[model samples]
Structures are given as C-alpha cells and as structure tokens.
Target: MPFTGQLEDGRPFIATLALQAHGTGVVGDGKQLKFWIDPWLSTEPLKYKFPSLFCLEQDKRCNVADRIPDCNGSHAVCWNWKHYPATEMEIEELIQCHRLLSNVSLSKQVDRWVWRQEDGDGYSVKDARNWIKGEVLSVNNSVYQWCKWIPNKCNIFMWRASLNRIPTKDALLHRNIYVENGLCGLCGEVEESVDHLFSGCRFASGMWDAIASWCNIPRFYVFSLSDVLLVLNDLPYTAKKKDIMYGIIIIACWRIWKARNDKIFNGSVSSVTLLVADVKSLAFLWFKCRHKEGCIDWRNWCNFVLPVM
Candidate 1:
C-alpha cells in the first residue's frame, strides 16, 4: 500500500509512513537501507506530537539555551524540527513494567496460592470459649466483620461474657445473683439458673404469658430466650422486620433482668403489667418502631399485661 493509504487511520502512523517515504540515513549500519520502521513513533504517534504542540501554544518554558538531555518524563529535542520518538526498547521496557492484568485472574492466583491459611482451627483462644457458648461461629465471619466496623452495644458485654466463658446458664444465674434468699425470689422455688429461671420458673412464666397474649403468639410458643432467638433467626424475608424482632428479644431479656434487679436491690416490686410496659417502652426506644404482632400496635402496651397479672 502507498504511505497515504495507512495515514488515513491515524496521524502518527501517517507521520511514521511519511518519515519512511523520506528515509535516507541508516539507524546504525552504513550499508544502503530501505524505509525503516521507527517502532516508538509507530505506536500512537499523535500522542508523541501532542505535548510539544501544547508547549508551542502555551508558555514556552524550555528556554532553548542548553541541550535538553533526554531522561524519562521530559522530552529530548535540539530545535523545533528535530525528530526523535522515545526509544523502541525503552518504550517496550516501560510497557513491560506497567503490566495491565485482570483482577479476576490475579485474585484467583492468590486464592489458589493460599491453601492452609484458611485451614483447620480458625478460632483463637479468645474466640474459642464463645465458640462453645454459641456466640462465635465460622459462618458468621462476614456478620462479625460488619458488626465490628460499626460498633454494637450488645457485642461488648456479650464478648466480655464470652471471654469469661460465662455459660449462658451461669450468666442467667448471675441475673439473680443478688437475690440473697437462696430460693427462687419470684416463685419461692429452688436456686435459679438460665433454664429454670427463664423457662420453667413461675416469675418469667407469668411475663411470658402476658407477652404471648399481647402479641397473640401461641401459648405453646412462649418458650425460652433461645427459642425466641430461633424464631427471630427464622423470621421471614424482611431484613427490617428481622432486626426489629431481634431488638425485641434484647429488650425482653433486659426487661426480665430489670424485674429480677427490682425485686432484689431496688425493692421496687412492681406488677407484671409495669414490667411488660417497660419491655414495650424499651423495645420502642431501641427499634424506634411500634412493635406489633398481628396488626395491633403495641400502643396501650400496659393493657396487654394488666389482665394476665
């Protein structure tokens, strides 16, 4: 093809072709040479001319006094017409160093390289105790990361309880630790534990009865806090609803503990109605939404319990 044929696509290619058309001197050898390939200029020749064209119109900063020695970013030129594109081998070296590779492939390489890094016994001693009590689990890695990114109030006490290896049963016992009478303070039974106090004991049973009727939750379903957690975990597709339900569980536990504290320390022996009211209030404060079970707003929350107590 004639030099002009290829020039139609790009100015740099055209410029290189034009140089080839007018070639006279050999690059190194004195033997007669035909039109030569300036590899550097052939690759994006228009880009090569741009900065000088820019320099011509804008401030002519290079005061043409000294021979502008060719380095890297700065250009090498003797006068306006002197011809030199960055060297072909030099450009190739630069291109090699640059290296535009795909992220997918790179990450795959990294993932394959790491075998045992993700292997057995992922838990440290710190997280091990919690692993036993059902707090820490490998499946919840993402959840734990997100939880730490934005601090959760529950995580601190929960983790402290975790580190102390506080058995859920033991912590539940501590809920009534201040009760000096040794017997069940609420129902006058044996020493309290998590299962006994919250599940079987009469005190919490009364609270659950009121809660069940208020929410229209089945009487059979009014079980322990773990059962409540199972319900929350199994909540239907809505994330907002699930979070609110979880908050309800937290508030319920807190309110139950507060009732225990009131009986022991405060001497504020309130009715079950008051306790249920506190639960609803705390739920609203925590979740910022009126928690309702079956289209009934927990508005007159006190009314939910007054009759049951």
Candidate 2:
C-alpha cells in the first residue's frame, strides 16, 4: 500500500493513510483523497451521503483530482458512471453530489491528515484516549452525564438505555440471538424494548406512578427513555432538588430494568409496589454513601424533602 504514487486503480494517492483512523480529518490536496470514500468534502464520506450516486460510479476508487482535474478550468468536473443516472432519485443525488463538489478546488500542497480532537498540540496518547472514551460513551449526539451519586453500573446502564443499546428481548432478536418470545417480561404485552420496558409497559407505568407520588412530582407520561430523563427539568424545584430527582429517576429506571431481567431469567414476577420500594431503598443507600456530607435524614429522604443548601 504505497501512498506517494498512484494506486493500482489509477487514483492519485497521498503520502499518508492516517485519515482511515478515527478522530483524523484530511487537509485535502485532492491528489490522495478518494472522492467517494474519504471525508475530504465533508465530515462524512461522500459514498454515504449519496449512496445512489456512489453505486453508479464506474471508478469507485477515483481520487478527487481525477474527478475534478483542473478546478479552475471551464469544464472543471467530469463524471464516470457505469450508466448515467436515469431515475429522478438518481438525478437528484447526482445534482446534490455536483453541488457539494462544485466549491472544492485542489491545492498545490500534498494531502495530509491531522488529529481533530486536539487543538494546536497535535495528537497525544491522552487526547486519543479521551476522544475514544467520549465516542464510546455517546449516542445520537447525546453524551453521558456522569452521576456520582449513583453506582457506576447504574450510570452505565442509563447511558446504554438512553441509546436503546440495552439487550432487551427485541434487541436480542435483532442481534440474531434466540429469544423464545419478544413480549415484555414484566407486562407480558408489548415487545420488550428499552423504551417500553422503562417507560411504556403497564408495570413500568405503575412503578413510575408510585415513584411520582412518593417523590411528590406530577405524574409524567413518557414515550421514550430519554423523555423520562427530562421530566425533572420542567419541575419547579431548587437545583439541588432537581439533581437529587435526576438520580432518583435514573435509579428507578435501573430498578425497572433489573426487574425485567429478573422476570425473564429467574422466573421472578415483578410487583409495582415491591419495585418502587426497592428503588427508594437502593437510591437512598447509594446517595447516603456517596453524598459529600452523608448527613441527609432518612425521613426527609423518604418524604422527598431536601433542605435548600
């Protein structure tokens, strides 16, 4: 895989293949950047942005320089398609592709890749590790907010649930795992999904109702797990109270997921009363141990009363 010369496919190549790695962005000279495969035009590779156009391309590995030989020339661009776009969709995609590449002009400098996670300092082991951690712990542009009050396992579970990454029955089935049934283990009704198990199932709804009454918050109706997490934001409470409520909500969801697993794997039936009690108990224990002062009264906690600090 020589990088300096032309590839066997006749695409002009660059001297570095570092762009293939994560957290690297290209400073395009066009000679080395694959027009369809590299993220030279945008943050995403062109092949993904215009799948139809990519399929029609005859030279899949053509360089940006090969496609747009002389950017300043009158006829600056050329198309090499297996067959020219015929359908309306294909034509639309081709139009979009051309529009995107229209502004791109080649530079005399050689193409090079640079680390995007660091600013002026370039790449380092620490920045790479941090970038990898952030990428792994994020989903759909939502980063995991660590809750020190709860156990690390609960925080991790909440992060996974937020992404619908939990191995619910439906998720398991999607992964081609053998699931005898996809029905909710707790409610035995709807398909077991991260959202349904934590927010939509009848048992889950009952548990949330109990939790709401215990915490003195208005009953919340949520269609998704992420919605459940945001319910505390609209509440009229002090920041400290809201923070505590956030932990309670997280712990409740964690308990709900645990109950669902218990039912499926241990033949344990879920009771809303028992589940709510467990959420309260477990949350109290975690918060008490992890709180800075560890001076919160159990009665006030049970009553959802936190003195303004």
Candidate 3:
C-alpha cells in the first residue's frame, strides 16, 4: 500500500494517495470543488510512531542514524509499533544508549561496569566496547580505571604487593640448614621465625642500623610486613609522601632478601653501612623512575629518610 506512494512528503500517507490517484492531493486548496478522506492508517497499531526511522530511535528502538535516508521519509518505519514493552533491564540499556547518543562524549578517566549478577559474558564484551569507544567503567574486573581520584588514607604499596602462599625465603633458608631446629642466627636466643630473622637477628639489626638514619623509622621490630604497614599507615604525613615511604619499604625488603641470600649461599657478610647505601641508592632510583613527572622530587626525602627511626 505504501509503494508508488507519496513517499517524499513528511506525511507519507497524504502524498501516497496523491501519487497513486490523479497525481494530485485528495483535498485541493486551489480548486473550489474538492474532496477529502481521513486515511485508514489507524487500522494498524503502529500508525502513531513510525513517521520516520530517526523518530523510531528517538522512541527507543534499535535503528541507527545512517538508515534515515534509506527509509525515504516513510511513516510505516514504526511497523505495528504498539508502544513496545521492555523489561526493567532493557529499559536501563535503552537509557544507556540514549546517553551515548544525546550527550557530549565523556572523558577517558571515567569508566563504569554494571555489577549485575544476572549479566553473562555479553556484559564484559559490551563493557569493553563502551570503554574503548569513550569514557566508561569496567566493573567486571573490579579494578579502578580511575584510581587517582580516590582519597587514600595510607600508602598501600605493601598491600598492593600480592600475598602468596609460598613459604618465606628465610624459612626456606633455615630449613635447608636445619629441618627441625628453630635456633636463631643472631643472638641464638630465639626461634628463627620471620620476626627473628629480619628484626632481631644480629645481621638484620646491623642492616637496619645503616638505613636507620636515612629511613628515620622507629626502632621497633614487627613480625611481618603487614605489621610494618599497619604502624606506618598512622603516621601524620601526606598520602603522597606515604606512598613514597611504602615504595621505600618494598625496596628495603628486596635488599634484605638479597643480603639474606648473600649470607646464606655466598658465605659473604653484610654490613649496616652497605645495606643503608643500597636502600638510599635504590630509593633514589625508584623515585626518579616512577615519580619524575611529579612536583615532589627525590631531594625532598632526605630529611625524612635520614631521620633515626
């Protein structure tokens, strides 16, 4: 019924009759005698909506913009559109689509992922596509696409370091020597647990002494890295500074590992001076490589690192 019709006219039905009939509209304004008939478009439920394809998308259908010219100004684009019904989630998807079309594009730093339990693999695909196209969050992975905005109460560098179930290198070291002996290597007065090896050992004490001035850390010993960070988190320093300190702790632990290996395998001895020198040099390199672009620079840590803690 629509073909050879008055298609170009925005009101397609009116033009169709004109084209199919006598090449003139039913109601002629110029002629004194004329006839008019209200077209029977109401026979279908879709009459009100499909004035054009663009209008269909505007009404929350899935048509794209490029197809507007293809429809050729047709009114049947809605095609039996009886106010299509959608589930709540479908409604949400429509809202998201509308946002993507109507607003100015978003910034890259902002991203979001839907935390819906019902979402399947399709959710991840959609999440990635939306993110690559513009600013959107990937909540599927539970990672912060925008971590820089969050206010950190403490430097979580230690926390960020993944904890594994592997046996401690120190325990492995001692176990290689004595399978059941829990004797200490420092004062020989306590068991060689993590606390005893790193904190109470004569060798470990010597290592701490060298970095004590540069680290300005307190003279207390904790059993684990978690304990160290737990105490450090409460320091009255800025979050940025705390992150730097956390970096220092990680580097120090790494050096401690090296020193332990040196003592155990190479039969080489370590000194506090040597360890301190290693910590400062490595800390400087770390800050230069990681934070060179920031307003805070390496020299600022001098007083803080040099403090006798």
Candidate 4:
C-alpha cells in the first residue's frame, strides 16, 4: 500500500519544511548578505527581481556592503549602481528598485535569516505545511488564456512560438548554430525572427489582413507575438464570439507555419485564399468539438456569424 498521511513522503516533506522555515531578513548593515543572491527585501532574490541589472554587473558575487556608499559619518544609505538599464522596461524596473532600496537606513546590527511565514517569526512544521498548500493552490491563471480554445499540441506550439523557442533560422543563429542564411522562408526578405516571421513579413501581414476582414474585424496590423495574443482582448463582440475568433487566430498562425514548412521542404506554396480556408475549417472543427453550448454550422462558420449565445 502507498503512504497516505500528511507527512507522506520524506524528501519533498523535508524540502518544503526547509523552504518555509528559513527566510533572509535584512537589517541594512550590508555586511552579511549578497546584493543579488540574498532574499533581503522580497521573497525572491534580487537577481530574479532585477535580471537585466544583474546581467550587466561586472561582479556577479558582490555583497551589499560593496555597493553601499558611506555618507560622511552619517547612517544614510545610498546605492552605487554600477550599470545602467538597457531598455525602457529595464529602466522603469531599475528606478523602482532603486527607490525601494534607497529608503533603507543602515544599522549597526548584523543581517540574519528568520522564518517569516510563521507567526512570531519562528519556524513550525504546521506553518510550513500550510504555506506549501497555499502556494500549490495559487496558479498563474493567465497561462490558460494561451491554451483555452486550441488543441493541446497546438497550444504547446503557440506557447513555444510566443517565447521564440521554436527552431526557426534566426533562433538557431542566436544560439551560435551556423546556418546558410537567415532570410525568411516565406517572404525571403529580412532576417526571419519570431516577430518578422509571424507579423513583420509582407506574406504574414497579408494573411492577418485577410483574417481580420473575414472575421469582420477592423483592419489591424500585427507587429509581434504579443500583439497577436492581445488582438482579441478588446474586440467589440460577445464572449463566445470572441472565443471563436481566438481559435481562428491560433489556427491561422499554425497554418502559416505549416505553409512555410511545406514551401521549404516540399517546394509547394499555398495561396492566401486556401490558407484562410484552412484556418476557417480547422477553427470550426475545434470550436464545434470544444464548445458544445454554441449551436453552429458550416455556413455560419464560413461567414463568421456565430449563433446567439
């Protein structure tokens, strides 16, 4: 028989207990903890919170004391940021982190680790168990938005495509893998990055335009994967219709990828009309199988008029 008690497994049980029982508490003396690796302010280490800044740092293992400035015999603390932010998002995050840390005052007391998840700042097995339970139940629900109306494999493909993890020519080049050329297979113009292959290329842009017109949506342009994902968010349609539209967009992306591969490997090119028809057919099949409440037919699907909810 299998174990079924609260402390059922030994390895995971001890690991969870250890994680909840220890948290670094910073007293701002800057001597005992690292600036990047220690969990001083937030639950996560500063390295994760400020990844861009951490990457540009010359010294990866520098401690907090090394970055703090001594202000003329006073207890005031100042950050000596060694590197500048590289992008707009990085600049905003860096400013926020600087403002948060600059407010801290250095003390003579040494920094120490404490059990922050428990009451009275002490460790308890019961507290650790409860903390683990809470964390397990808290999911990043936004992930479901990517996989909602598509098949499992297509959803996984979309997720990887969004992250630029697909083995496209440009992605291979970025990983130091040598390729003959980086031009897009579909358009044969410009380097085939994730954004360019999906939206920036003329071929892909034309497909998006056809899709928008078919769905009766206004003529909108897609510049990146983020734009594709967020295009249906604020549309003027019912929730069910929006779900169908989302499915169509996902199918269109898959079809574009398929057509690109077919052209490269099989020396065959599909026209825009045929590609749009494939998207409509596949989307109709998926929506019909997945959404049972909506009574839809082939004519309504082809015309993009979803039945009343």
Best by lDDT: 2
Clash count for each candidate, listed in order shown: 0, 0, 15, 0
What's the CA RMSD of model 1 in angstroms? 32.9
Residue 86's lDDT in candidate 2:
96
Residues 1-309, candidate 2: write the lDDT tens digits.
Answer: 222454334444331223344434354566777777777666678877887787677656677778887646443678898688999989998888878866767768787666655354767767555654554444336666667788889999998888778888887887899989888888886777887787767777788788889878877766568778878778888777777778888888888888888988899886888988888888888878887745677898899776644
lDDT of candidate 1 over 62-148, digit per residue (tens): 221222222342433333322333556545533432231111011111111111113244425443334333322332232311112
Query: Which candidate would rank higher by TM-score, 1 or 3?
Result: 3
Shift of residue 65 alpha carbon in model 1, Å: 99
Which segments of candidate 1 are over 4 A away from where they belong?
A: 1-181, 220-224, 235-237, 289-309
Question: Mind giving the per-residue lDDT tens digits that candidate 3 earns over 200-301?
Answer: 455565655555546565553343444444545667766665666666665665566567657655877776667767777667655654564433345665
Candidate closer to the true structure by TM-score (higher is better), 3 or 4: 4
lDDT for residue 199 in candidate 1, whole number 0-100: 52
Could you give the C-alpha RMSD of every candidate to the true structure, in order shown? 32.9, 14.8, 28.9, 11.9
Query: Model 4 residue 201 lDDT?
Result: 66
Error of 1 at 242 (Å): 2.7
Ranking by TM-score: 2, 4, 3, 1
Most TM-score-accurate candidate: 2
